[model samples]
Target: MNDNNARRVVSVIVVNEASVLSRITDLFSGRGYNITSLTVAPIPESKYSRLTIVTSGSVRVIEQITKQLHKLIPVLRVYEHEDMVEKEMALIKFPISENLSDINTICEAYNGKIVNVGENVVIAMVSDEPKRIDNFLCAVKRYNPKEIVRSGAVALER
Candidate 1:
């Protein structure tokens, strides 16, 4: 994609209520915009939830999205993240035959550790920048992972 289509992160704070997520997603779908990743969770001690959305578009398109978000009744705030700290979590399961020590060391490097050891598998959890998590997945390929699940990016402005 061109620079105009560079990836963007948009954070939306909205009232916690049914259909809120559906409404937000519908807005993107209605506009033919694809959301690369989305993470949502209730804000502590409040009736609001924060939605972190990752997508790509021209500056104009992003601005349009922000404006549309503000028009949503439940949406209380919307902003495109500029300088932020973001992280994603991934869980990978490998056969027990893999070297445990090596897996432990690799996980440690990614701010993670082996979270569980099953009778036949070893499960590791890693939380790190999205790019670094991609690298970690590549680094562990030799172990023959059985399953992998990754979370959407969660971010906070710095």
Candidate 2:
């Protein structure tokens, strides 16, 4: 990353169609732009889907990408988010023998909790700001996590 490179969150609203996602992703890949995180979800009671994309680029690079996104046929709107509420979720599995109380406390601090307990594993889910989630992942390393699954970033302009 360069000094000019900064993380950006872009939200694209598009008509729901089978090929829309493929085309959008193709646009990024074809242009050599990297998408660090992408979250797509259908808008409730609407014929559209919202795609939240997280990427790092210089200001001019992000502007170029946004301009190209608007040219796609199915795209309804595209904008870079500012003053947004963004979040990410992570699920970490630890051995059953790990300290459940400690894990639960950590999860609670991150707006999550142990959601599942199996005979041999315990799954803790934490949803929080992306940076905080990164911190949580680091904080839990001492417990010897068996597996970890993290979701892409999602955001909404506040």
Candidate 3:
């Protein structure tokens, strides 16, 4: 595989501390790794945080990243998601005048629903597989979405 096109999602469990995020990001930047998506949040009732990072590189480069991450003082565990169930959440806002019924139908198709409705705007939220979310975005283009926000990928080993 080409070095630039290989996509991998890596999950890192690290101590929840102020400088941990900066240290981890510095590691990537120093090594010239490009992170496509990054999400960090503390695990409930625990002193650790989960960092979900999406990046691309060749197999060798990924292995190097894994090894380096393991060497970090705050990092506890790292997992490269393989055969896991991953999901992403997205929210889209569009003009309310543009057929609310049609928007609801499209949202339903993606296992989403209208999350908010105002006089001028309608907001829909969806949590689905990455590919499905991508398709949903493509399908809703005709609505002229005012804004779209997608959350980082979250995974559970199945």
Provide the overall lDDT of each model, using Cα atoms, as 2-decimal numbers. 0.95, 0.93, 0.90
Per-residue accuracy of model 3 over 58-157 as CA lDDT, tens digit each? 8888889999999999999999877788888999999988877888998898889999999899999988988899999999999999999999888866
- Residue 36 accuracy (lDDT) in model 3: 81
Candidate 1 lDDT over 51-128, as tens digits, reads 999999998899999999999999999978889999999999999999989999999999999999999998999999
Question: How far in Å is the alpha carbon of 116 misplaced in model 3?
Answer: 0.4
Q: What residue pairs are clashing in model 2?
A: none
lDDT of 3 at 87: 83
**Which runs of model 3 end up more than 4 angstroms from their true locations?**
1-4
Worst 10 residues of 3 by lDDT: 1-10
RMSD for each of the candidates: 1.3, 1.5, 1.5
Worst 10 residues of 1 by lDDT: 1-10
Candidate 2 structure lDDT = 0.93
Model 2: CA > 4 A from native: 1-3
In every candidate, how many clashes are there? 0, 0, 0
* Candidate 1 lDDT for residue 139: 99
